[model samples]
Target: MVDQAELELFRDNVRRFLEEEAQPHYEQWEKDGIVPKSFYRKMGENGLLCVDQPEEYGGIGAPFEFSVVVLEEAARMGFMALASNLSVHSDIAAPYILHLGSEEQKQFYLPRMASGECIGAIGMTEPGAGSDLQGIRSRADADGQGGYVVNGGKTFITNGQNAGVVVAAIKTDPAAGAKGTTLFLLDTDQDGFSRGRNLEKIGQHAADTSELFFKDMKVGADKVLGRLGGGFGHLIDELPRERLVLAAMAVAHARGALERTVAYVQERKAFGQSIASFQNTRFTLARLKSDIEVHQAYVNECSGKYQRGEMDVPTAAMIKYATTELEGRVVDQCLQLFGGYGYMSEYPISRDFVDARIQRIYGGTSEIMLEVIARSVLGR
Candidate 1:
């Protein structure tokens, strides 16, 4: 267990860093379609990226809670783009390399990743496939020279524009179904790898989501992550933690939304009184606040299970599915209270409303999560 005071200090430090660095430039970054790479470097300098990684690889190896705090703090401040992008870099991508990569892969990647000298990404979603891993069509064929040539495309990839390293999933044997899947470590500097435009989104605009292509990209067999034909299992194995990370963010972000809405209602006037004095406004605030606090406890419990290695896929999915859906409702209701101003892009509630949307769709859709949960209860 981490010392409580030290964790509070860490949270304070993270908030100070984001206020000074990210908060000021976030609007410009949103307009630019991406956050600058220098900001990532600064995050690294402050030991804000991958806090759970080990010291030998440039991390403080702080407890998992520390990483959760970093993400939650960012989300609580309404910097969804920063929170979303950093979640990919620190929570999703870095862990794949840490847990599955070869010694050489770790040495070459984790240090730079920890230092924000290199950014990491995962390539999984294809044009045709969103939630189903078995539907992936990108492929890698053995070259008979102790290597393979990869050819495929990935869309909606987070951190795509600035990725120094990508953990790409491709089919080694398409006929074999999920059993044939393989994961390759793709170094973006390689000749055949190309990046498409930074795709625009409804929100989280500072995140550099993009479409990536690989054409005859040859890599040594050594680039294989975990083992040949292990991609699906590897992806599944990681989902619990991945979903947990998103769930945590959802809870924190919703809290932020509620915070904004409460302040807005208290100050904004209605029929000769503050909007918050209205019974309808009071009830809505009460309900949302109650829901968020209850959900926070649930998320905290799930996170503890994860830290103890006791969390299962279904339980993780439950938290993710529940909290993200709650986030959607919370933000939308909060926006409703803002009246026409909620529709404007200028208000933080508007951002919260839009940003809350993708939480359900990504990290496995609510439907997919339900199916996973169903399998546990109904027998697959």
Candidate 2:
């Protein structure tokens, strides 16, 4: 765990890196439809990408909170596309290998992942499957030579275009429903692995969402991640951390919206007075500020629980659902304060509005989260 002084120092470094390395290029990256791969390497060199992995694996051996610092600072600075992609690399995919992979797999992947020589992505969402993992058609069949042949496709994969490796969910037993699922660690350079065009999106343009295809992609027995038939379990196990990450970014993103809107209103004038002087403007901001702080507190509590390994699924679901919902509302309200300017693509709030939409949809939809909470409440 990083001490308060060290964490704050790290935060300062992250802020400086974003301002110097990311902010100047963000608009261009958005126009390009993807962040350049070179930036990831820059991040790895700066010790900013995966701060938590052990030093032996080319990391600084910092705690997971260090990774959260990266996530929160990026989102807080309105570089949410970067934050979204980094969360998958540093928070979700790398941790899966770190925690569940065999020592050999760890030895090969973790060092490279930590170094940004291997960008990581998680592949689970399929074209036909949204919230229901059981509905996925991607499958892996055992070959006669102790390897498995994978044939399936994944869509909306974060970090997909630049991914050097992927931890993917595949159905290993078509007849076994949830029990049939398994995870595999794949080298994206393999002959049978291919990538489709980077998908266009309404927001987060630089995040590099892609459609991935596998046709007779072969992997040895050593490529299996976790148990062969435990993919869903692995997904579930990792989801709390994943969802918590979403919640944290939601809070930070919303706060960024508020901060920018605050500056805008104070300078934006109407009726011969600064808009911030208006009662409506003051009250709206006051309300959002209050709500944001409250959510921040709750997120802080849950985050501590997560760091202590005490966070539960239902609680994680609640925070993710609540914070993302708040994010949507916050951006909408903040945009309204900007009046016509808010609708312009040039305005930061405009991007904040669109980028926040997927936060609720991905990482499990808001509706699915409610169902998870309901089940916990009813013990069903």
lDDT winner among the candidates? 2
- The 0-to-1 C-alpha lDDT of every candidate, in the order given, reads 0.92, 0.92
- Candidate 2, lDDT over the whole model: 0.92
- Cα lDDT of model 1 by residue, 214-234, tens digit: 999998998899879999999
Cα TM-score per model: 0.98, 0.98
lDDT of 2 by residue, 25-76 (tens): 9999999888888888899999887788888777898877778889999999
